[model samples]
Target: MTESTAPETGTPSGATGNRKPTPNGTTPEPVDTSATETSAAEPTAAATTADGASVETGEAGTAAATTPPRKRAARSPRTTTSRARSTANPSNETPAPDAAGEPSASAEQPGSVSIPQARHAAPDEVDSAAPADVEDAPGDTVDGDEVGSAATPVQGGGGVVDDGAERPVVLRLTDVVKTFPGVRALDGVQLEVRAGEVHCLLGQNGAGKSTLIKVLSGAHQPDSGVVEWLGEQVRFANPQAANKAGIATIYQELDLVDDLSIGENAFLGHEPKVAGFVKRGTINRRTREILTRLGHGEIAPNRMVRTLPAAGKQVVSMARALSHEARLIIMDEPSAVLAHDEVENLFRIIRELTAQGIAVIYISHRLEEIREIGDRVTVLKDGRTTAASLPARTTPTRDLVSRMTGRSIEYVFPTRVNAPTEPEELLRVEGLGRAGEFDDISLTVGKGEIVGIAGLVGSGRSELLETIFGARQPEQGRIYVKGKALRPGAVGAAVRAGLGMAPEERKAQALLLGEPIYRNMTLSTFSKIAKFGFTDTGKEREEAMKVADQLELRPRDVRRPVRTLSGGNQQKVVVGRWLLGDTDLLLLDEPTRGVDVGARAELYQVIHALAAQGVGVLLVSSEVPEVLGLSDRVLVMREGRMVRHARAEELDEETVLDLVMAGSLMEGAPA
Candidate 1:
């Protein structure tokens, strides 16, 4: 014999009653008695026919249950007259359907529409059409595809979610709403995170992904909503409050002080102290332990962050978060500055955190990482949830990208057209070496050709560009432009020789963020815009507008501040500056690093167009796919030396990785 618990039902239990209490504790009754009689008198529509098909309804109140699923029953001409009456007033009477109760599922099945999966009904009282306000009681079984039980609360002290449970809620956001002037950045956004899960927030720019992170980190506050921590509702007035609550956010622009030592930067605000003074020795000891755990024992705690390489500096930032005992860490584009090996190290650390029951909120534009580290994903678009709580193992990348961009993109990289043949050599470098940075680099780029420079981070790719562009003086080498020898460290000579570079650090070395687009576009060609030591504003504006139009700059107003534009648009302005100068050689370093997908496609088109115009292009990027797809010829560099040169057709990711790992052509010389 089976023992069963009594089903909990309200006052009108198991009765086909005229009046029932709504889920929100209100009685909703039909105002007109005639409408109720009309609905019941009509024959009951088929719930589901044989072969799981549905019946069709017509204006004559006739139900055709035998209609095929592919074709709908023809509606009588009276349908238009019936629709007209219905449009005039919406009533409780069941609306007339053109064909079937289920509508046409054929068109939706093969397309982007999401179909619900089947699940077993609960053992308790079941409602086929449950009301919205009816909250499920604790331990009540729900449809697996529709609803899930609330996450298990955190167990550890200090509000940090413990790792012992099978599933633990690390972060909870309810009804989060944020607004900016005329824009509602986020409206009623809801999210739940579990310990040990890598939750990816997938969205395009301005999709409220960044805005949601801001609110969680206390950088912005929702005008309305309750932020719950470990099942307890709490309000974070500032980032410090969130930090103290064990939430650490690592933004794309790392907030570490470059001038300070690694240990000092890691423990900036909360330094180890003894009595009244900072304990330098104690801090250094603890710093070494953290770095060693992160597989970077070689990173000196005393070294200034500015002096270290880009990859090392990124690791230092991660160390800072770990030092704070961050239980829920948010990484925004953490791999943007990292090389392949450094990215591997970061994944190792992330895995270690998950093992310890910590949650990671990873936000990245790189789809490959989402496949590797993400356990679950949430996609947002236009400040609303397009998809929520999708398992990474079951979801396809194409689906995620479609949800994020709101368009079906067959390919991310644009098609490359044939570049010019028999182009002239615009710039040449021989034995270009910057001591300690890179060494013995030699390459030449011809006009109307795109030459790609590929290497792992810290391999001196950026240094080579700087050396050739006169930003950094090469200790030993000669640079020639159009067969003319150029002096090292002389910007005037480089620019006069018809060479221009869009530096890797766009904000620092390329554009004056505070300046207007027109000023930045003409900044490189100031001498041409000046006549007899007098600046010509008219010529500057005219030149700037021309390039802006060429790059498809929106607004087309050259006077707007560059800082106001998106990252992709700003990069275009920087590239436009050099293009306007009509430089014989163009050096672009990481041109699409932080740009969104749509903008990246546009930028690639611009780059190819520039190459077709006979502008010798030197492209430096860490993304192997970008180099392989965009360049006519690829040059792999390591330790400041040109290691391998191959045609784009001959180079694959494996071959490039082998070349990068081999570390220089000198190693391949007949030994």
Candidate 2:
């Protein structure tokens, strides 16, 4: 909220209205200045207007609202300068967003959220909404107070009890801009989020949505800009300040501590400790209540975080936010790791949160999820606001997608080829049984065949893929690549036998994130590229570059670190690593899991091209549609069993869903 006293006659002090006040505490001077010139862009943050109002220009490094120049000196009190320097300059690499709402390159960020002092306290009405959505909205501003200022609980899938009237503005920004050396991450972006609303932030990869959120989260100080939290112009210096201010961020790469217990992670920064000892019982009980409230009472608070499934980890992450007494929660690709039913559960929780007047900033590439879960929508294109005030449910998908990618997208798959009827067998798995994980799973892939597996999260689909990759030994099974049998539990043996796998968890199980592209790519092929018992770096690069080129890797620089690339590009690097070897049979588990639509299309083309070259591909995806679209043959798994098998053309997503859920489709063979 702009808080300035009205002048008795002329422009107010620090108004920037026809008066530029020099830093020297000059006499009440009236130097001529025009708001029109400032309209193009606000003045640099270093220059504060005379009327006690500081002009902040962008998201990064800027104070929240212009603070009294004296108060601004203490900005980001907890932010370590050394840490900032390391993150700001990533070894000559460009700093980018971590999650969709993830932080840009930064040193180790201190945990900010505190343990909930009042575990079951309802949020105060004075401040119960999201962070800022800025200016340049023209006339589409929804007066939030016209709607429900007091957000209370409502029942069912009906979104927050917004009676379709304008909501009270919780956060507002004007002409937010952030720039890097060669790129402007935010180009005068404008947005607004009202109380009790689900403001969906939409954009393709590299679109400023992440950057904007980071600025709001206080992880990245904006270059210059005005950040209005609640009704007062304010600036958050660090993530801790944002958290203390009632904003919670759940990044895409979930910042949970896998080594800790559920309760421990929930109260990491602000544990219930006294006399140097934590109150474990209190923390566990509170964590249990939070999980139960989230409809996940089954997840024990004492359980190790590493033991949980992707969905379970997500719940833990949310539990941490709840522990913070967050008024608004920022979810970055929250659904990426979830399966079909899990997504529904997530939506239920989201609705419940919003009903309590807690605003949610949802960032995702899936338009379908947006329609199902979002309220007001804002689209970011090339670091600028392309569209705001759009209705999530009513906006045409093509319009939303076109705005995101700057091109119309057709939900099309690469055409599958009808390979020779008598194709050579590339892989054969017979009586594959991994104690308790999967049993008697027999499958075959012929040359040029794209085989897909569809299953629930715990149906052992990923386990089967792991066994084939030699990450896990099968108790009773034979895996044959071409005609050679692979030794069980031997990654090297599998690699030597012309087999390759891009695992389900790419970040954890596939790529060495911080390694250079060439190193990560040629790691499995060092022997092939070695000369005189010495690793010939030149040969390694030549081989890695060949596969990198084949995949059309962006930037075309093999020396770049893998961590700096986007999710889609990172997946490509993982796939390209395998391409450097004699890989006739490729195993792809959730190949396009976190990739964007534009890059998803590119990945699909890469898969098709590999198949065209007679590479037998075995794929697995929780998304039934992806399996139905990309595979020639489909195998549905239920529990530890293969429930159904059919040609992709003969099945649909509905049938596959039924098979995974009930172990049989309407008229298909039963498990």
Clashes of each: 1, 31
Output the worst ten-in-a-row residue range by lDDT, candidate 2: 81-90
**Model 2 ranges with Cα > 4 A deviation:** 1-164, 256-316, 417-422, 664-671
TM-score of each: 0.68, 0.73
Candidate 1 yields a Cα-based lDDT of: 0.62
> Compared with the true structure, what per-residue lDDT tens digits does model 2 show for residues 59-116?
3223222321110010111111110000000011122212112222224223222211
Candidate 1, residues 487-559, lDDT tens digits: the string is: 9988878887888888777877787777878998998788878899898888888999999888988548888
- The top-ranked prediction according to lDDT is 2
Ten-residue region with minimum lDDT total, candidate 1: 81-90
Our model 1 lands, by Cα RMSD against the true structure, at 20.9
TM-score of 2: 0.73
